[model samples]
Target: MLERDSPTPLYEQVEALIKKNILNKTWPKGKKIPTEAELMKKFGVSRGTLKRAISNLQKNGYLVQRQGLGTFVQADIEIPLERGLYSFAEYFQAHHIDYSNKILSAKIPKKTSKVIADKLGITINDKYLCLRRLREVEGENIMLIENNINISSAPHIETADFSKESLFSIIERYSKETVEYSETKYSAVGANSEVSSYFSIKKGAPILYQEQLVHLSNNSIIEFARVWIKSNHFTLKTILHRK
Candidate 1:
């Protein structure tokens, strides 16, 4: 149900209509929405317009894409920042939120860059494993994480199956090191073409960027990471305690 003759753009009309349906419980939470073809025919809109509308609805936290599965209504997900050591998987598990991970790459580069070497306290010539993964919540791509880990600490890290395993857990089990704390820096950024493709969002959309250096109990830097989070669907919350 959309207004074609209204001055509002077709995509905006479609977005409003879909959002209304979601808010009114016409499309209940966790239920798959109509197919793109069906929506296009119903709205009498072009494919690009329909996709744009769906993307808008997704960015606003109303819908989720399940890769091969159809898009469905989204539920709330909250990640607490008060804890020093945070794990995305643990949070999802605790909240009982259905989630999945897609590993893009996990390999040891021939040459380590100065920036990565400096952060990990390794020589530029030393080898390190770089892992890139996308985290999906309720079938929606919500965050992209790029982790640079020292190979010397975890020799067989390159061969580890990250799809079903957590990187921090791997380090602890393989390297015999526990994550003590992390020095994190946060910033706001606009999604570039690469990031937009990963999140299926429009280029220049707002994103929350975080750079962190993870350390072991002995105070050795073991991992350096860059995380990009979808701004609309995720929020970073922290509680302050004064000693």
Candidate 2:
């Protein structure tokens, strides 16, 4: 039963119902879904709520809508796993897929900005490896990462191929560390010229910006990363368990 008093909105509830049906094979992929009117009657939801739910599902790659026709479940959208914190390497290894990356720039920057200083816990003048990389999955460039690693902590930075290599993996391999958890913040912002170029998007387009600081089990900082993702390329799905 849908919760009326819960904070989750009505349209989201409608979306969840439809998504559950799709996942359970009741509404198999490639089959055209019920029309808006049919769905409104079945779910007992307002037309606006039904439309919003459909739009959300479409944005998440679950449904495809055709002009002058109807919406249908997409054939290519595999059911996504439950969302949680996972390292870049862990994600690839889990799927048994290999990805290619482009090395943009790797250098020791002498003047660390205030933001970088706070993230790496270093002085403003401290030198660090300012690693810039473009990550691609299946020949599509989807993410751009600009990282600042403290030079003192990562002494072997020169040898690491941050392009095809995961920074977290390299850090653990070279420094013997394990990233237990990280503090991350997400927000939407307009993309700048440099950031938009990597994804072939126009400047000022909305992008998802994630600032993360990963820590190891020993309480040492492992890596600090600022990832800029094309808003359309990925969908973030999470499960919130109630106590």
Candidate 3:
């Protein structure tokens, strides 16, 4: 309902109502909404007004239009996991999608940096398994993840094949511990030389960089991870509720 004195246009009010349905999951991902005529009848608005509302939502990623077919609800642009709750695989599983990982680099590197030692809770000279992997969704390369694991904590690291098995699953199987939570920081940065080549994008292309520290229920750091994600492949959501 548009109020004449509210300063918002009728089309904009209609657009907001459609968006509310989307956010509330009334129109789930990949589902099609009413056609233009149907929406016009339902909202009691003009055809031009309904079209304008749909157009605005499409531009903002809430709806996707097909050339011959009517518009469908967009695939959820964001993973719904909270910042500290789940692993990447958990998030994927919740969305009913399969993800594959390609091992790019793996080595037992001597931990020499002070920062690395502090995070891993080990001596500067302790050993760590440094691993780099590229993750793909629906066969599209979308993220590059690099992780450092304390060798002492992960003693039987070579037994499992990462390509077929889940890294967190294997770690829990071997260590008899579960990751309870994690902390991460997100930022945007230009791809570096190696990252640029690995992602197959241009050198200066923007990427979403996520740095994570995964912790076990025992309060030990389980994984130190850094990731570079393709710019538009993913989105993050945070909810703010007023008390």
Candidate 4:
């Protein structure tokens, strides 16, 4: 029952209740939630209030609405972006999310491009290991990652089992250098044929692209990565604090 005299808005109260039910597994993933009519009657709220509550939940990634159907619990994964210098593998392991990686290719290219060379703070002729990998959770391919690491900083990285290892961990272990911070840029892009094939989505599907340059505590760049993520299957979250 809603408190009619409370200062809190009725829509907010209803949203909180629905979100609680989701987190508690009372409403499981992919299952359709109660219809609008049912929910309005149960909460003794007007149609507009009930819709506002549901809309908020959908915007926050807690619910998904299908045309001609009803709203269902969203089953996508949420990745945090404010973890400082942590890797995706580390984050998933810490959160106990079941994940796996497939190493598509790993090699030291004979030629280096000017853009990648500059990002690694190396000359255009410097050799580096390029690793391409696909990350999956619950049998869905959610991310495609391409990492370029300076060979001098991470020796033998070309032979490492990236499918079972975190690139950041390996770099720290081999170079004895800690990652101080990273500069990242995020943008939305349309998937090409290759990316579309990897995610099994239609061509020109929306993708979230992230490019990052990782630096050591000494201020030396060690790694550059380009990541393509399935937009609908993942959400990037960040927490900001005021100084």
Candidate 5:
């Protein structure tokens, strides 16, 4: 029930109540909420007010609107994003979410983009392995990753099986070096045609983009990586400062 005389806006009150239902599981994930008319009737508010509240919830990750379908509760994944310059392989392990990786491509490229060359401190013609993978969890596509490894320094890496071995470990064993530090640039973007198909999302849907550089203990670059993260379900709790 809304307080007709209260100072807080009616729509804000409605948003809070809806969010509480989501958190408390009163409205379980994927369950569609009532229609605008029904919500207006239930809350004794105008259609405009109900719409405002619903829009607010959607923006804040509490709800998702599907075309031709009523709004539905969304499953939220709040994790430590941009951590240690690695990837979401840890997110699944930490949350106990069952996940699998599909190697899209793992091969040496004949040509390199200047951006990638600059990041790895190598020439455009340098020998490097490009690894592309699609990761899924609980039958939902989650991440697309591309790792550009400077295989020229670790020639034996060309024959290694990434499915059975960790890339970092392989690098260390072959090159006698380990990751000293890393830097990552993060941003939000719209899903491109290639990305939309992989995630089964509409074109231009929100996507999280990241570019990272892993450096060896000697300050030489190990790998330059790029990641495209499926937004909506994932929210970043970004508080970062390394001591």
Candidate 6:
């Protein structure tokens, strides 16, 4: 039952309900959804309301409407990142999937580059922690992750061994600050020579590049990351909110 008197719009409530069905396998891949008239009658909403809901699901990669056969659930990816942040180690452990992190470098750099300085809101010569690692599954590396952390926000953070501990965990535990949220942008980028060497792939391989800035409870930015993920191993799904 949707909350009719709530501030949330009726169509958005309908969209959430339909998306839940798709996620829980209630509506399997390539399975056609109910007709618009049937959905309208069932939800007690107008055609306009229902169409907006379906249109959003289609745009977000959960549904596809063929020209002739109506709408069906899309063929999805192995992993989906909706709106939350996932520490790869914890996720793999929860699912009982064998995975390991090989730490490439984790230390406080003497001087940060201009790009890193701007991201962390620090001066170019100021100290900041940098971490680079490879995420391996089944003997193949699929992700290269690099993190630039605000040293002022997480003082003495370099003392912790990232290979044996979670970065966010250490930050929250030691600094007594909460990681509130993150802003992320996703794009397709071709791998250059440095990245190609890490993945053992040729230069110009298609890869998913994600840039993210994490904020603390006080709304100060604390971490910035550049993640290169093999397209074959992951999929990213984000919701659309017009307001």
Clashing pairs in 4: none
Q: Tell me the deviation in Å of residue 139 in model 6.
A: 1.2
Q: List per-prediction Cα lDDT, in the order shown.
A: 0.85, 0.75, 0.77, 0.86, 0.80, 0.80
Residue ranges of candidate 2 with Cα displaced over 4 Å: 1-84
What is the model-wide C-alpha lDDT for candidate 5?
Answer: 0.80
Report the lDDT tens digits of candidate 5 across residue range 1-243. 788799999999999888888889898987998888888888899988989998878655668777777788876677665465434665666676667888899988889879888888999988788999888755567789898988766677867776544567777777788767778778999989999899877899999998888888888898888889987687777786889
Tens digit of lDDT per residue, candidate 4, span 11-79?
999999999999999999879999999999889999999999998887556787777788889876677
**Per-residue lDDT of model 1, residues 121-184, tens digit only:** 9999999999999988765688899999987987787888888776789888877988889998
Error of 4 at 144 (Å): 0.7
Model 2 Cα lDDT, one tens digit per residue, 1-243: 578789999999999999998999899977899999999889888899899999888756578776677888865312234565676656776776556778788988757789888887877887778788787654446678877676566578667877666677777676676667888878899999988777677899888898888777777665688999766636565666799
Candidate 5 has its poorest 10 consecutive residues by lDDT at 81-90
Q: Measured by TM-score, how close is model 2 to the native structure?
A: 0.64
**TM-score quality measure for candidate 1:** 0.77
Quick one: best TM-score, which candidate? Answer: 1
Against the true structure, what is each candidate's TM-score?
Answer: 0.77, 0.64, 0.66, 0.70, 0.67, 0.64
Question: Candidate 3 residues 33-83, lDDT tens each?
Answer: 988888888778898888899887865557777667878887744766445
Q: Which sections of candidate 5 miss by over 4 Å? A: 1-75, 81-86, 164-166, 240-243
Task: Residues 75-126, candidate 6: write the lDDT tens digits.
Answer: 5335546637766666676666556789899988777899988887888888
RMSD (Cα, Å) of model 5: 8.3
Q: Could you say which candidate leads in lDDT?
A: 4
